[model samples]
Target: MSAQNTQSGKNDKVDDVSGIETTGHEWDGIQELNNPLPRWWLWCFYLTIIWGIGYSVAYPAWPLINGATEGLLGYSTRGEVAQDIDEFREASAARDAQLASADLDTLRENEDLFRYAVSSGGSVFRNNCSQCHGSGAAGAKGYPNLLDDDWLWGGSMEDIAYTVRHGIRNDVDDDARYSEMPAFGELLEKEEITALVEHVRSLSGEEFDAAVAAPGAELYADNCSSCHGDAGLGDRDQGAPNLADAIWLYGGDREALTDTITNARFGVMPPWGTRLTEAQVQAVSAYVHQLGGGEEPAN
Candidate 1:
């Protein structure tokens, strides 16, 4: 009998032995319904099961005395990873060479090169800066926004390079840029601090006592003006905050402002120059510049 005829005969005999009748051709009160599994599908399923058994035996599927079973084929996930990294390096050699050779400004002019830097730098930012700056680079209180063009230190490629090389408040750094916003807690009484807070708050049009602000004016010049500037516009070189701006690192609330004055807040940004290569630092700065709201500063 042909294969088809043999299968049909076996199916026909199944109904009688199983005590099931065929829908049309019943045998011994046994019915064989029209439902039948495809031969190819069943075979494939069996083959996959057999393959799985063989794979489990040959591969590192089971844990042993010291480690997992080393596959007979000697396939290793770590080896595969290393191989992938080598492939990546080989593929990106041209780009890496360009980055190494080119200045940050020159690289930024090339959109493709800039994009490559952003992708590479994004990984580094996520690993390091994301803790304070957030995954989106939106800063928490006291931490400045990386997305914005506004930088306490200058935003130029060279400027960023300098800041990253020598961190603010990084005392361990021999060449660290240092500025201390004197604590007003000892200088001013509780009521006087409240007046200054009200005055600072009024700069942004938040609720404040005008009468108290008048008195606070003199105090601002005496203590804060040395760094924050006469107009309260801030001195970027000194890393002094612009009290006039709507953007507040700490909360703009009266209590927060009062606290800030009482015990001056110093925000510290870690230097990346020590940890990362020059090219890597440049890439990160470029990526940060691409974050929304950043713009080229006037020469």
Candidate 2:
């Protein structure tokens, strides 16, 4: 007999013991039993197939060239998120209006507005300003640190706001605080620049060779004093940095000072006035003002 029940001849012989019709095909003389599947199991299998088809039709399914099918319901996660954001913006509308118009001078006097500004400004700073200035506003070598009192331009509330509004050394805004330091490398000899570097370092109370700094003084008086002042105390009006103080923007080392004087640093800051909203500018100004470096407005 074949292993499978594929016998073609009429062989409806009954098993002598069970009296059930047997398949002629057999293995080792054992007959095969013919049975039908349980009705319950077949019904369950059909129901699952129907459910899958219905689900695919109701929701997003089937990939297309442009995108997935939008489905009959037309629901989207992006739309839900946008709705939530719109609701939040609507709730803050009044506060935002007050913030936009409030005077910067007395903003801190109002506890509510002050807190709002600082909080909002912090978020703005992290999002926009953190790339240059650190997340904590400590700043990098080229950037000015917000935590310290040292400022190239004045750090008063009015001054900070003005700088933020117009920026420094930027070409986009005509009102930007414009000042240029001549690249001494082109004008002065190599020895003269080195001597100037030594003199500059000595002014900060660092150890220096007096012999070399002697001639450098005359050079500094003629070339740099007009902007840096006679005592190296820096002129805020001109945005010249103070050399006499210990705080150094780039670095205090010989190499750093040498580079600055030789090639000069022409750093540019973007004018926030054109980029941000009036309220946003005010908020960031308020946040920076509270950072310890900020000064009281001049009397």
Candidate 3:
């Protein structure tokens, strides 16, 4: 009734059929064969070890206390990339100089330079201005549409360039374009604000209760007309938007209009003068101007 194998002595014997030695280890009376690895595979394994050692000595592979080990070749991928960038910039220097200095009025005469500015500016816009202005430059609720003629500031290339360089309502730059709209909720009663909102809506041709808008007209004249103009045409000098036009920055809806009047809006744009090169500013301006909204410079 014993469970142990009685043929344990045969486990270590060479297989007579295959003439191969057995490993002497067995499971359930099965024996494992002892076989050497192929010579080609063994040689490949040795070659890999040699390659790893050679690579460590010839390339920047090992880390050191302060930096990485400058291998025998002393090569750096980052340095090579930087060198390539410098070469590219050097090649484009002359074109950039022309773009930076060319008068805004005369820029259109040089077709090649104008095209270059627009192309370069498109790249700059994507990197810097696209977050707020959108990839297509259509703009959002609070942001002004670059494809429209309703510019808060002037729409000329020079004006656009100036605005881009100095920015709007940012405190960091002293030369930044600044404007403030008083929060009328603090100065007027709820009834007066409601009436004024109706009157403002009427200016844009929105249907409103005639009785409500009548009182609102007086309130608008007393509080908003100076900067917005008596006809609501807007003053470019003060950066007042044309309320009569269909374009609305925040929204033209009643609730959105109410919130804007109650809280007031002070949208701030970061100055790009300190952030971007003068040439870059010019390029971006050109790109924006060509977006079908730009106007001829005023004589």
Top lDDT hit: 3
lDDT of each residue in 74-173, candidate 1, tens digit only: 7889889999999987998788778756676566678898888889878778887799889899988877787776667677665665676677887667
Query: What would the per-residue lDDT of candidate 2 be over residues 151-207, giving only the tens digit for each residue?
Result: 888887678878988998988999999788999999999999989988898888998
Which of candidates 1 and 2 reaches a greater TM-score?
Answer: 2
Alpha-carbon lDDT, every model: 0.76, 0.85, 0.89
Using TM-score as the measure, which candidate wins?
3
TM-score of each: 0.73, 0.78, 0.86
lDDT of 2 at 290: 93
| Full candidate order by lDDT, most accurate first | 3, 2, 1
For candidate 3, lDDT tens digit of each residue in 30-140?
A: 767777789999999999999999988998999989989888998999999999999988999999998989887778899999999999999999999999999999999
lDDT: the better of candidates 2 and 3 = 3
Candidate 1 structure lDDT: 0.76
True-vs-predicted CA distance for residue 223, candidate 1, Å: 0.8
Which pairs, if any, clash in model 1? 20-30, 20-31, 21-30, 21-31, 21-32, 22-31, 22-32
- Looking at model 2, which ten-residue stretch has the lowest summed lDDT? 1-10
CA RMSD (A), model 3: 3.8
Worst 10 residues of 1 by lDDT: 1-10
